[model samples]
Structure formats: structure tokens, C-alpha cells
Target: LVRTGFEHLYEVYEKIDPKGARLLEESEPYVLTYLDFPKEHAHWIRTNNLCERLNKEIKKRTRVVGVFPLKQAMLRLVGAVCINQNEEWFVATHFMDKRSLLFEELPQREACTQETIDHLLQVIDSDFKVCREVA
Candidate 1:
């Protein structure tokens, strides 16, 4: 459904922004790449809060330092923060269900839910009838 909904977007990107379009095209496969993972892992990995939290921490720490003597110093600080964050995650209880991972991967695609269909129809204010359908 994501691919179907984004077809027009991909086309528009291709025409007006070739570079972005190229990147999108290259990354198209990874759009559903989450499907390759176990169903249990998807929910946790789907939201980027972990990344956001890490970035926020990095920004907060960097602000405290105020200034760096060199570019490598900033990088080293960032790396240290990342390593610290990784250790924290390792010590914390895992959010994924290991039992669910024992199972195989899930279906790659699914039909849109009724709620989604209705919401989109309401937003578009149309049944999305093409000119041919009107004719």
C-alpha cells in the first residue's frame, strides 16, 4: 500500500528532482526492508526514537563542551556518546520478543485496512474515479 500510495510521488520526484528521485529509486527496496526482519522486531525498530534520543544526547553533550580544538575532537566526543548509549542499551532489558524471532519472516505486503481506506477517501474528498470511470 505504501508503494501504491507513493507511485505519483516517485514519478514527480523523478521529473523535478532527479537526484532525489535516484536516491529514492535506489532506496525503494529498503522501504519494505523491515519486512525482512522478524515481526517482533519491527515495532521497536520502526520508530526512530532511539536515534532521536541518541542525537539529542549528543547535541546536549556537545553544547556543554562549547568548543572543540579540532574536528576529530568533536567526532571522538560523538563516538564516545554512541558507545555509552550502546552499553546502556545492552544493560537494559531488550524490547524485542526473542520467541517471536524464532519464527520465520512475515509476508512482505498486506492490504490496506478499512480505516486507512476511509481516511484517505475523506482526505481526498473523492472515490478517486478516473476520467474514464466518469465517462
Candidate 2:
């Protein structure tokens, strides 16, 4: 239904701004990614608050530092911030209510036979050889 509405809106938007419509059309695939996930999860996935908050935090921290003397120093600061944020999320309440429709689990893997194992080993050996040659 949302897709249909967007398609209709696109038609209207195209008449007003062909170039803008073309850009939107190009980005449509990415914009509608939430549709692929469970409807209950769409709200969380579609919202930009999480990303915006993280970016704001990083900007706020960087502003205090003024200038980083070394690339490694900047990296270490950003890495530490990320690690701290990760720990907070780990201890916090669930982002999405567990009782809501759960995401579909991935299918179980097939048991690997000897032939399959041999083929995988052969592929790994070929990749290793290519990497060695490149180095």
C-alpha cells in the first residue's frame, strides 16, 4: 500500500520536477528497504534517529578536541566512543519489543558431505595462492 502510494506520488512529482524524480527513482531501491523486513521492525529500521544521534555524539566529541595531532589519535577516540555506545546498548532495554512479530529465522544449513568439504578446501587453497601471488 505504501509502495503504491509512493508510485502515485512519483507520478505527480515527476510532472513538477523530472530531475528530482529521476534521482528519487534511482534511490527508490534503497529507500524501500524497510518493506523487506517484518512490518513490526519497519518502524525501527526506517527511523534515522539512531544514526543521527550517533553522528551528533561523534561531532560533539570532535568539537571539544579542536584538532587531532595524529590520525591514530582520532581513530582511537572514535573507536572508544563506539565501544562505549555498544556497551550501553548491550545493557539497555530491547530496542524492539520481544513480543512483537519476530524476524524470520534463517534456514538451517545443510550437512556438509566429504565432496562438499573437499570443494571448499580447494577453493580456499586457490584463494590463498592468489593472495600469495598478489603479495
Candidate 3:
């Protein structure tokens, strides 16, 4: 399934952005996995936060000067940020740590509760409507 998704993305990326497709091809497989992640799971790893954090780091480094003497300075700053984020994530504790607490503390709910399900469905429907309107 994952391989098929990557194949699909490789095809789409080649069509829409040949340069990006080439870059993707040159990247490690793990680095390119986000592009092929399922749409439902995409929201979990929203790229906006990643972009914003990178931009923040770049802006911080660039604020010392109005402009860089050459593009190398900017590239070096952003490259350092990418490397730092990669290392930081490797050392970070993740969701599994909270699993025991969640399993023990979660409120028990009846599976046959139609009212709860209907209310949740209504909430989702309203959110969809609002999203469509905003879009």
C-alpha cells in the first residue's frame, strides 16, 4: 500500500513539478514518505508547522543583516535548521509514552449510544459546511 502511494506521488510530482520530482528522487526514502502519507493522516503531520518553524529559524539568523552577501549564507542557515530538527526529533519522546495513561483513564462509553454518535456526526457535518463556505 505504501509503495503504491509513493509511486502515485512520484507520477503526480513529475507532472506538476519536475524539479521537485527530481529533488524527491534524490532524497532518502524516509525523507519522501510524507509526500506519500495517507490524506487522512496528512493532517497529523501538517507541513505548515514544519515550514513555520523553519522560517522562524531562518528569520532569526537573517535578522542580524538586512541582506546576505550571497545566497550561501541563507542556504547555510536553513540547512543548519533542517539538520537540527532531524537530530532533535531522533531524541524526542513520542505518543507511546502516554498510551498507558490513556488506556487506564479513558472514560468508558456504551458502543450502542446512537445519541453520542449522532451528535458527533452533526458536529462533523457542521464543520464541513463551514469549511465549504469559507473555501
Candidate 4:
């Protein structure tokens, strides 16, 4: 059986299918990029079900009308459905709770200045160089 995690599983696949394994290794950065997101947001980020469900709702509503006399009428119905869907789950209990999502405001910072911009660029350049060396 494949062992329980990414590295172990990758090692096994690498032995069995070197070409496929190389592709995965190349994609490893993107495949695992979700890990860089806040854990709480991972579920929503990793799946398109929410969007699919929203589209399904829109289609269901539009299908009922069969046809609209004006494009605006259809748009209005879709807009309302979007608003309702947004409100239905955009709640503290369901999700979209800023605190739970780690959306707290940052501590106030000094006003931006040209000097700070240059310093930030230098830090970024140095970090990028370090990463290039490691790679």
C-alpha cells in the first residue's frame, strides 16, 4: 500500500513510473501551493463545488422562466439568485467569518516612503537570490 503522505507516495511513484513521476515532481510546486494558504481557507480554495452549486441554482431559476421578454429580466433574476446565495452562506455560522478566516486587520504601519520601498525591494531581491541558490 502507498504510505500515508506526499513524500512517501512520491518516492513509490518515482520508482514505478519515472516519466509520470518527473511530471509530478515538476508540478510539485503548484500541486502543493495550496499549503501556503491559511488552513481555514483550504477547503473552499481546493474545490469548485460552491461555484458549481451557484451556477446550478442560476440555471434552475432561469430554466423556470423558459424565456424572458428582455435580457434585463433574465439578468435581474440571476442577480437576485446570486444575492440570495451569497447571503445564505455568507454568514458567521456557515462561513465567511472574518475572524475564523484569519482576516484580522494588520497593525498600523508607518506611512510608505521611497526609502522603505527601496529597502523592501532589496530584501525581496536578497530572498530571491537565496532561493535561486537553493534551487
Number of clashing pairs per prediction, in order:
0, 0, 0, 0
TM-score of each: 0.67, 0.56, 0.38, 0.47
Error of 1 at 43 (Å): 3.0
- Candidates by lDDT, descending order: 1, 2, 4, 3
The top-ranked prediction according to TM-score is 1
User: On a 0 to 100 scale, what is the lDDT of residue 4 in model 3?
Assistant: 42
Better of 1 and 4 by TM-score: 1
lDDT of 1 by residue, 12-125 (tens): 557657899888888878786665677558778888899999999999999999999999999999999999999998777776665676666565556789788656644433
TM-score order of candidates, best first? Answer: 1, 2, 4, 3
Give the deviation of candidate 4 from the true structure as CA RMSD: 15.7
Per-residue error at 86 for model 1, in Å? 0.8
Question: Which window of ten consecutive residues has the lowest lDDT sum in model 2?
Answer: 101-110
Model 3 misplaced stretches (Cα beyond 4 Å): 1-54, 92-113, 131-135
- The lDDT for every candidate, in the order shown, is 0.74, 0.72, 0.62, 0.70
TM-score of predicted model 3?
0.38
- lDDT of model 1 at residue 49? 91
Indicate the residue-level lDDT of 3 in model 1: 58
On residues 1-135, what C-alpha lDDT tens digit does candidate 2 reach at each position?
445545655665677679998887888888887666655665688888877887888888999998999999999999888888878866768676665545476333346566766565565556656766797
